[model samples]
Target: MRFSHTGPAPARRDDWQTLKTLWPYVWAFRGRVTLAFACLLVAKLANVSTPIYLKDLIDGLGMPSTQLTVPLAALAGYGLARLMTGVFGELRDALFARVTQGSIQQVASRVFRHLLALSLRFHMGRRTGGLTRDIERGTKGIGFLLNFTVFNVLPTLLEIAMVTGVLLWRYDWIFAALTLATIAAYVLFTLKVTERRMVYRRTMNTLDSQANGKAIDALLNYETVKYFGNETYESRRYDHDMRGWVDSAVRNQVSLNLLNMGQGLIITIGMTALLWQSARGVVLGRMTVGDVVLVSAYLTQLYAPLNFLGFVYREIKHALADMERMFDLLGHHQEVADRPGATVLQADQASLSFDAVDFGYQADRQILHQVSFSVPAGGSLAVVGSSGAGKSTLSRLLFRFYDPTAGAVRINGRDIRDYTQDSVRAHIGIVPQDTVLFNDTIGYNIAYGRPGATQDEVIEAARAAHIHDFVASLPQGYDTPVGERGLKLSGGEKQRVAIARALLKSPPILVFDEATSALDTRTERAIQDQLDRIAQGRTTLIIAHRLSTIVHADHILVLEGGRVVEQGTHDALLARDGRYARMWELQQSRTAETP
Candidate 1:
């Protein structure tokens, strides 16, 4: 299947667009946002006015003047104002948190929904852990922006403007000019340095992603690495990836600290210079000592917001990058998407056919070349071949996992592509070579193929799969917990459970890909009876390596290097002494040697 490069990770643009798109998510909770803004305004008003009370107190009762009554009253007023400011600040924080949490939940839900909607092929190549990280980062990134952008940066900027405007009207024009220059300089310098630091963060994020992928890959293939005694090799690869991550992280931290230190120094020097001028004015009677104290206090308050803007700017950029990658995934286009005006199929009376079909995973390689075959409606057929000879690929084509590069696959004498993907798959039930079971009860796993099936229907299907008795003997019977992937069950038990699932689906067309390959002779023989019963009224396609299992199949197609070498009933193919006959002889000899 060809994957179109369409998603949040656009060629030239990172996730910035996705972050912008999240405005709507924020707007969804407009009432909460409005409340947050109101709280923010109250907090800022209180915060910006605190220094004014100190100015009034100092002016009303001269310092060291022995005016205890006036001084005490001024102190009380300042304390009360501060207390109220703290309360509103706390309220604003709570409101900001509420908005952030809501936005995260909303984005995470959308990403999860889109992830599940993607086709199987897209999932085949990606690690589960990495995908999980992307989803988490995407959601949290948006949340971080919501909390910082609206609550911190926006309110702080508004406060700065209010302070500067008041300063200009009440004090010298030089104080206001100095405040503006200091702010503009602080922002410009911080932005300049942080832009460089962001390069390190971007590098660090890439290395982190790689490190995570390595760990996930190793964990998923732990069994293979252990069997091959390649633990040292895997560990070395992981260590190498981690080394890069650590190096980039260190650089990012160092660069950020440098930027913060410089910003602090600049603010300190700018405020000191401004205060010196204010003190000179006070001595000349143009301003008072109380006014100098006010000017100094407001400078600190104004720069308080400026302090964290550097971090917020950097984070917002990274957040945008993360958002882009997530959006890109949500926007992926299926090369084999159903055409417009597609219809759902209702008929089960249809023949399955490969009409001169050609397909490949890559442009230069063709796995199926002009393959043509027809299985009569309600007939059973088996395809036999070595791995990668197009047997399994043919089964996938039957389900439209991939559209043929050329030619057409037909059902009921109509092209299968005419039906929507869901419609095409709804009529087919597949028991793949490897069965995957969820961590749930035995009954849940059985009923997964038909979610609304009754308890009796589930038990009947299990009985037909020959696993009902085994499950009934368990402590919890149908409610017995099946560990992840049914790890608690033996190989044969898992296959039987899978068979039960497929049986319960009750689709007209059934495809088995090495259904009994993992079972012992006794188990295989027992299930063969159920298989025979199930195949009686349905169209079945079996792909198997064991020749004995399919001897009863009405027809078997022998494949070699993507071509059909021979095809016939078991007796006729045996007499022909072709590839199928040789395979049968080899398998029979092996069976005879078994204890």
Candidate 2:
């Protein structure tokens, strides 16, 4: 239930490198990219030629001594130039569409797959809300970066260069200098301001993520909030988080408007200077009216790309900031990765032993110390202890969720560490104290234990767990919906479903971690009978709290504060009148008084 983002963000020096990671994905479709560039060149050439045709058409029509016949060829050429511009532009987009879409898919999918590969400790510390939001933004960021970089930024620069060159050759050097100087200033200003504005957007995104986490946490625990009558408290907390986002968003908007106005002013100054020079030349009879019109057309055409650059500059900065979160998630390494040439676990006999094992989640808080136990082939061991006696830690260690700090756990005289985690876990089945199912059909959750299991096989496992009759009686039968964490089902019913799942797995070693804690006394007795029958040939480790439930165990070990204080059969411990004997007496007294 705890949630936090990794604090102390990396410095801005890493932002450019984050975007650089996408190059390989983009490069994968190099053939299409080359064709798209060719189309881009053709499109710009057509666009630049449109003004030349217009100038010529005007000059021809405005001739004083023209013949009576109309100049249809000039009019057709002018129209064709305009039409070709649009056609080539669209063709470029069509060719490059695959590159943009593919890059987004690969990057998003790679990041998601990497998150799954991370260890349980990383997942425990993650906030689901913020993690999902970062992915969503990062997916969108990839598309934005590819489209603008290829279609907008490159094309705009090409158009500006062509325009500047045409003006200097046809008119004067002054026209080219004014155009180049204005473009240089506009680009520099936009970049500086956009970088400054990124701080506001980065803050806004952080607050947005916090708000999302608060809301998701509240809804997931809806029953708890309602039981405590704290609905208003949760709402107030979410609203407080959103208020910071609102303020940051407003500042982001204001800075954006300022950026737009400054870009507009520079374009205006550059346009006016170029136009005044053209008109002055026409008045002095140094240039034709057609020349003046051509110059005006060139400045107008060039300014169009400059305006687009202003927008592109701002969006690119935002996109890069969004992608930074995803890159960080992908860069995290697993804390308990398997050794380089790890082998598979050969689970014959399935004997398990913890050889003087010691472990701690942190340096200062040890959960287990010198804990040692063994279960022989086809034998059973019951672990009994109070909370914080490290009963649960034993199960996690057996599953290799964490490596032991001292000593080792072995199976068949081989260290479990020598086997890959996947291979080691494949042979073990656990029915935990708390069973949380996915928001899916009951049959689907049951099938999760052994994927591709036949319908008859699923029904047979359910029958063994004593839940088949209940499931078959429902209107939807096996298709009954188990809401989030299986909340729609009663506590006893959920535990039955978990039993059915574990039974379906049929692992050589079975673990019952307080498996019947949620059932009533009668139901518990009946299920325990079934479990005892099923444990005949399996290596079973039963971790239980109630003494009456585990009286039939082959061996029992009582743990006190991470150390074993007693070990013997159920009758031997009781006959000795030790800690197990005292706990058994206390539980029997309560059981007799209850009914």
Candidate 3:
């Protein structure tokens, strides 16, 4: 049921380590980043320099009759400087856009590719919805981090330093000292509170992912839920997770409010003290009205970015959290990987053999115990067994989905492990028992057998499987969309589509793993006739539970408890009166009992 991921999983890493891992992506766009840094510097300088102009203009306008009045040109220059500050800042963002976008694109693409390269086990264990959410949130976080870290955080610090130096130069050292102390306290408080709130944020994110995962899982299995009439049960389960999310989300909001209020209180107190000191100096005749105004102007400029700093800081932390989980998924190690220097499967003769293979899905539970079998080029072999007798494991071994704990599977006299997995798979065609189609048009699903196949070729394949007339009877024909997992199609129809797909693939080695299990007796017999015609002089491996399907196989294997208890031609095996004989009798009895 699982698709193959051909590459090894990257080493597992912590979440925050993703930031470090992301440097290469960022560095890839280094030229633009450097230009953005220059713009940032120009913008900061323009911003701070404009406040000084305002200070000079205030002082000039407020001069006594004995002093010269502020020039109209001076006022115009001040306005121009303010406008230039915004222009430079915007230019910085524009220049940096590519770096941000390219970095996000690189990371997202790598993660997506890694998912495809991961082992079936890792993917089967993950929830599609949750994994997708992590990727979504992570990419968004990259944008936030890039913008805020490059623009907001850096600018705020630069502006604060400028304000302090100006205060010390124009006013008393006391003003600069108090300003530094107040900012340090504010920053410390914000950092501590934001750090504490991280726990709540983390919890809310986890709950949200869980809720999304549950909702998607339920929706994908919508038919099953309705079949069991468990709509209310599903609703209750979803609501239960939602309630927990609501609680966590509410707490997260409350903590944010508390942090915001605390930050506001500190800033308010600092502004009051700063303005009060300037007023005291003016009243004592040590400073003028213009000086007080200038001091206030500088403080306001300093506070603007400082306030923005709080928001930028919180956003960056949240982004880091999202990136962490996403990167962890990217770091997953593939349990199944190709050996070094492996070459493409030659498949010259298309013969297959299980050389004393011992295998298991889990180490403690062996599925095949030193089972060995082979089919010569252009021969047919049918394996029949009870449900737990490991009939399907043979096909998986030949495909190299998993390695045997002991021995190996060989194709054309070369160990399957010695060839590239993709090439090995490319040479084999399978009509699986449970054929799950994509939510797409009928033609699209059919064409998936051989990508880029011509329309005529698709129709011919469908005709070969005896499903073309049924499809043509529909209004949309091949264009009709199959519902999720082809739920709109009948079981027999799905099997036919699968058969057509394998036929289209035209691989040298073919596996029919319960290919007709879903069909009624009439359809089975009809398809079996076509299958028998097509299977001639081609290496074919049949894994079937229904003995009737394999009655005339060139060679038959009756496996019991992972060991082949009997093997021979149908007539020859029946003549022996062994396990194969008993199974054949049981299937015939079941067929006779069916009304």
Score every model by TM-score: 0.89, 0.94, 0.92
Candidate with top TM-score is 2
Query: After best superposition, candidate 3 residue 250: deviation in angstroms?
Result: 2.0
Q: Model 1 over residues 1-595: C-alpha lDDT tens digits? A: 3232111212435444665678787888888788878888887887788888898888877656565447666677788779878898788788767678887888778878767666667878776766777777777777777777886789779988999988988987888888889889998997788766666665665556666777888776777899999888878777776787688788888887888889889888788889898889988999887898898888778877677776787787777666665666677766567889988888766678889989888899889888888889888889999889999998889888888999898888899889988888888988888887898989999999999999999999999999999999998999999886787888888889899999999998999999998798888988987897888878889998888888899889998888888999999999999888899999889989988
Given candidate 3, what's the lDDT at residue 589?
93
Decoy 2 TM-score against native: 0.94
User: For residues 397-480, what per-residue lDDT tens digits would candidate 2 score against the true structure?
Assistant: 998888899989988778898999898888898889999999999999888899999999899989988899999999999999
Model 2: lDDT equals 0.87
lDDT of 3 by residue, 84-181 (tens): 89998998999999999999999999999889878766777898887899899999999999888898898889888987888888889989988998
TM-score, cand. 3 vs. native: 0.92
Q: Which pairs clash in model 2?
A: none
For residue 218, model 1's alpha carbon misses the true position, in angstroms, by 1.6
> Candidates 1 and 3: which is better by TM-score?
3
CA lDDT, every prediction? 0.82, 0.87, 0.86
